[model samples]
Target: MTKNFNDLVADLSEIEGGYAGHVPPEWLQGRTAYGGLSAGLALAAAQKAMPDLPPLRSAQVAFVGPIAGDIRIAVDPIRRGRTASFIGSDISFEKDGEWPMGLRTTFVCMGERESSIDHVSHDYPDVPPPDIGKATSRGQALSFLQHFEFADIKGNPNQGPADYLRWIRVAERDGLDPMVELMLIGDALPPAAMKLVEGFGPISSITWIANVLTTTPETDDGWWLLRSRSDYARHGASSQVMSVWNTRGEQVLTGMQGVALFL
Candidate 1:
């Protein structure tokens, strides 16, 4: 069954002092929920816990273990200030008669305020339109990929430059919240390291951090730009920088990820 993007967000349940949710296999990346889905759900839980906080400023998450089955998300308010707040969230699950932390995240939220400094260090990349690029099928085998479409602006993933740019968005959840959609689209690109390897094996994102620069609402167009570049790859790990741009050429999010490679 095809699951709506908003439906996944709705699955999260508010509980005493925390949140709870179940991840069906349709959203599974391997034996666990997709990395982005897990992070998004955790963020949703954080939002429920701290409703008055401003837009998301930044989120740092460590994928400590696999997230599977019924999971409990616990959120703690680290500190609350006038313009900003720091919140901590964790995903816990029971397996083999023991419960363990599968993921840990710290989210920073900042409210609107007057600021004298306003500038952007970088501009959106110039790339061909999605129609001119090839649609990526490498991700087709993954169940979660069904929720969205990916078009690679660069050539073949294995033969292209170390950099990649793509146009991606949810196929059905057109009205989805921008921040929630960013979580799903942030990791849409295949690891840039895959271009350096001979063939596909396996790569797992160990840690991910996303910084939100703007909180504009989603537009009717629904497409978001995803650009990723590898910084370095060695010792069975790869690090990369990522950014998400809206159709209006606004840089909505910037992120960094560290991935474990088994290729």
Candidate 2:
């Protein structure tokens, strides 16, 4: 049976070193699972290993290989400082009699302290609000997409600038940690290069770096603005600048992703 994000998360069992979990095929993208789910699971394992750790400030994730079926996430606390803690988590599983690493993540969790300076470097995209009554759709018929709701804003790439803008939210968001929630929805959009390609092709995210702008990232009615801009695309690879904002027009998270495109 297919399981939602919350249900899957609740099934994670704590092992000796980390957490053990399973990913159903309904959440798989091709041979692997969704990028957001892997990254979110790594973060979730890290949180479970150290419950008192501070809020997640930033995360650096490397997608090494395909991860499906039963998985083991080993968490290692690299260091703990007065206000910040650094932890490393690795997701791996045995397949075909060989253990292949699926994902490796380094999390920087820090507590907020008074700073002498504060500034805003970006603003929310000037897009219309997400219509809750409108129907949601997905660009591709990937199996994992059914877990989330996408209200895409149609546009023409020839107008002025080109980008993928949409409002996305999890279909099952009850009782989710704020940090875990961000990880789940942050990488929900496909590579911005998908619009630039003519026909459909396989694509995978190689690396992703996310910075948490605020500890308490909240939006109205679970709707968050998602924008992905591919500034460079060439030579079978592409890079995108990703951002997520709340309904109150607050910038919550900023991310950069490197995708390996097989055009």
Candidate 3:
């Protein structure tokens, strides 16, 4: 049976186990699964296999191959411990006499482990939200953003180079597990933003890694502020640091992404 975009998104957000897949629309311009879709599916599979664990605090996914249409995903439970569980999965497209594109992900569950903290120091950007009139649909901004909602804070639109504040969160999915929601939100920041800072140029990420801070938000309702900045670009490589916070003014998670420039 064919499924609508909403239904597929709903399935991805759910807590149930088993394969979760989506057929990208022609408009997406990809014959295979979107990168974010694969990442979210891998996260969901990991979550479903370890439902008793705490919320997923971190996930590092490597896009080893391209996922064609009609993808099939399988989950493997690595370890389930008292305070945390480790899980991983592979997403492959089904085809006759062909290899499928795949991705592998590891999820870490948060627990009550104690730790010592050092001094805290990080400056938050001060910028007003983009006028609602200028707000654009995710489809208007980027093909993948179509599945998400974004509110630009810095209102910087120069394609040459820029950095802006924004609020991002996914539309609700029925039976959506909070962990899946968090993972989707965690993966939404685009690498294109880094290009803005490094001057216009073609860039591709060979691998993306996100480390979830221990103090991530506990709820999904609030608008999380994402402060993204480009720190370095050289030798056909670039990197960006992203800091996420809940609407209540609390630090959630900080992410760093490394990019490989094609040009």
Candidate 4:
């Protein structure tokens, strides 16, 4: 059954030790849930568990195991100070017989403060605005990718340079929180280094580190520019640096991801 992003999150239940949730069959990436969805839920749970937290500033996600059928998420407050809050989250699911780790995360939230320093080292691509009329399904993406639409896409998976640039957005983003929305759409692209692969193969996102530039960042019709490039790929792994920009050309989130490729 097809469901919106919000619906999947609403399916979560706050249990005793943690929260329980379910993923629709279509959202599965290989044997696990989409990296974005699973990670989004963990962040959502943390927001629900503690409403007093400030805007999200940074986050670290470890895709430790696959998450299908059912999910368990637990969030603990590592510290809560005057302006910044640090919280950790753990997501788990049962496999054949044992409970394996699904996702482990740490989120940092901090309010805006008066500062003489404010800058971004990354540059927004010189591409024109996303061709709204050209947004369409590539049809070659994973099952969960059907939930999104891409435009102004650049880069060929069969070619080199190892990068993908596109404007992407959720089909249904009404009523969704900004941070939560960003969390789900941030990792929408495939691993950058995969561009050099000749064929599709097993790929796992091992870790993700994200730095939020603005919690109030917004884009036209929910579209965000996603730019990712892999400067290094070796043996059986790849590391990518990414940046998300809103329609206003504002940097929303800067992220780094590690992927394990079995190609």
Among all candidates shown, the one with the greatest TM-score: 2
Model 2 accuracy (lDDT, Cα): 0.87
lDDT of 2 by residue, 45-158 (tens): 888888999999999999999999999899999999998899999999769877689999999999789999999986566666677766565534448888888887766343
Q: Which candidate is the best by lDDT?
A: 2
What TM-score against the true fold does each predicted structure earn? 0.89, 0.94, 0.76, 0.93
Output the lDDT of residue 147, model 4. 83
Whole-model Cα lDDT per candidate? 0.78, 0.87, 0.59, 0.84
- The TM-score, computed over Cα atoms with residue i paired to residue i, of candidate 2 is 0.94
For 1-263, candidate 1 gives per-residue lDDT tens digits of 55665776677787877977777777788776788888888888887777776788889989999888788899999999887789998998778878699999998888567789988876677554465234533245447787776766654443335677778877776555567777777877778888786777778889999998875545435678888888888899999998888777778899899999887
- Model 4: weakest 10-residue lDDT segment is 133-142
Regions of candidate 1 where Cα sits further than 4 Å from its true position: 128-142, 155-160, 217-220
| Candidate 3 Cα errors over 4 Å, as ranges | 1-6, 9-20, 26-32, 116-122, 128-136, 155-164, 172-175, 192-194, 197-202, 214-222
> Which candidate model has the greater lDDT, 1 or 4?
4
Q: Which sequence of candidate numbers ranks them by TM-score, best first?
A: 2, 4, 1, 3
Give the per-residue lDDT of model 3 (tens digit) for 168-230: 765444455555655556656556455355455455544556656653455445356676566
C-alpha lDDT of candidate 1 relative to the true structure: 0.78
Residue 51 miss distance in model 4 (angstroms):
1.7
Q: All predictions: root-mean-square deviation over Cα?
A: 3.0, 2.0, 4.5, 2.5
